[model samples]
Target: MWIVLLLPIVAYIFIQIAFCRVKSQSKYLRNVPGKRPFLIFGNLLDFLPGSIVFLDNLMGYLKTYGDTILFHDGSFSWILLSIDYEFNEFLYSSSVHIEKSDQYQFFHGWFGQGLLTSSGSTWRNHRKVITHSFHFSILLQFIDVFDSVGDNLVKKLESEAGKDSVEISQLISLYALDVICEAAMGVKIQALEAGNSEYVKSIKEMCNIVVDRVFSFISPRLYKLTWTYYREKTALKVRGFVLA
Candidate 1:
């Protein structure tokens, strides 16, 4: 009983100590726009209760903070979020800013060292190899695949036309998946017709897990302690098995 009682006090003390150490380093970013951060927790408390509202809450922040905002995690590691056109243009156009953020590691397990997760010379090489695939002439060949997918999408949407409300995002996603599978791999998975397949189910679940991880206040290294981590790994295995 005594040990359990003391645990909270001990944890609080440690967090305060850690926060003090990092506070000076992050002081410069305090002037930036966004919600005022709390000790140790930063802006993480705002995301609690339901992480499923992450996207909606992010939109709210954009409205409150304009284009550029600053946020930090529990560890007081500050990150600048920007949707300003000039800032994005500069970041993407500059060769010096080729490196991606550490948060991208969350995708490493599923995407491997593919273009999205790779950087530096590896990214350059991957981009060069795939550059021709997106050429106008090459993309023109996929028109039939797009038309077929669009037809399937229209048929699916027609089924939902009279409903009081319709969630079209998932429908569009399935259409894109079908098109990609058929055009890229020559495999007609018919994702729109069979969106509940284990592979597609796993893809959706894995995507949610990734988004949750990004918004989570806990450290990614500690994810092994949670059931969601195992679920994500299982989803990855399912996806890999289906792809193979």
Candidate 2:
């Protein structure tokens, strides 16, 4: 009973320390410009509307802050946004700065620690292994797959050509998926032809869940209590959806 009572106190103390640490880190970036953060939520509220709105807001920030801005999701997450060529070159051309940002944690469930999510020596090794897969000659071999997929996409657009309005985004996503599966995995999932297939729908749903999770302000530990988490868990069970 006493331990339970002390739990809140312990948690509060831990949070205070973490908050203080974040504050100290921010002091170095004080000269960096960004929208003033809110209490606890930090700059996350600015990005909650959706990707389009977030991109609009980000473009405004770029105009106002002149790139190389600093912001954080919460006290524990400090992010540096830089678009300067020299800064980007320095970061990408060096092995010392190979760590990904906190946002990539959301991809852990879907991609595990593969190329997109891994870092340090693991990332280096993965990059080495996959380097040949993207070589010009290797990519040229997939031209047939691309040509077939492009033909399908053209036919899809042609069918929707005189419509009042058509949502081509979903069609394009399916097109890309079909290409990736055929070229990379050596399997034809036919995502465009079978748009409503369980494989295609599960992939789309998983993407939606991941995007939502990235913008969500809730604690990940509490994710199990939400429907989205359960849905994501179920989607991961889709057979033949090999995750790297």
Candidate 3:
């Protein structure tokens, strides 16, 4: 009976001791400033529920914390956002730190071990293979593709000039994508000419799913349970498009 009554008290004391240890360890982060992560929750409360609002909050937080900030979601993870020019150069130039972070593995389902999410020998090999495609001669050849896409974009813009303030954002996105399709994928998506492509629509949905996955605190569980449906659906559509 006494042990049962004291369970809550014992757990309470243990939690307090744990928090004290964590608070003491906070000094190890040094001059880096960020949200005060609470026990269990960490900085989960710092994140907004919606992607748009979360981005707004992130920008606001960055404004307050400067270019560099310690982003903590839980005791399990912490990311140091180093946005300064010199710091970014140092981070990317280092061969030792070439490994992608653990969080990037979450995106593996979408991109697999492709160049963007790969590391070590796999990444090195992928880089070598991809670099060949971007060789100076190959890039020079791609200039014609870029010019065609740009001309198409200009024609679309000119057509919209007489309209009451047309949105050029979609046109610009399609133009950029057209360039990428031709230069990188070795295919012509013709997204701008198509106007309403199923593949393009799927791509947009995939972007929204990615944003939700990346920004949410419960990314792993959320992705597998809810986000995975749209992700897989869109992924299948993209694959179908590529195969076609």
The model with the greatest lDDT is 2
Local error of candidate 3 at residue 97 (angstroms): 0.7
Better of 2 and 3 by TM-score: 2
Instruction: Give the winner by TM-score.
Output: 2
Off by over 4 Å in 2: 1-8, 49-52, 83-86, 239-244
lDDT of 2 at 38: 82
Write down the TM-score of every candidate.
Answer: 0.83, 0.86, 0.77
lDDT of 2 by residue, 121-199 (tens): 8999999998888778888888999999999999988998999999888899889989998887888888888878888
lDDT of 3 by residue, 19-45 (tens): 776667567776798876676777656
Task: Report lDDT (Cα) of residue 215, candidate 3.
Answer: 46
Candidate 3 stretches greater than 4 Å from native: 1-28, 49-51, 163-166, 219-223
Candidate ordering by TM-score (highest first): 2, 1, 3
Identify the superior model by lDDT, candidate 1 or candidate 2.
2
Where is model 1 poorest over a 10-residue stretch in terms of lDDT? 45-54
All candidates: CA RMSD (Å): 3.5, 2.7, 4.6
What C-alpha lDDT does candidate 3 achieve relative to the native structure?
A: 0.75
Deviating ranges (above 4 Å) for candidate 1: 1-31, 49-56, 241-243
User: What lDDT does the true structure give each of the candidates?
Assistant: 0.81, 0.83, 0.75
Model 3 residue 32 lDDT?
A: 91
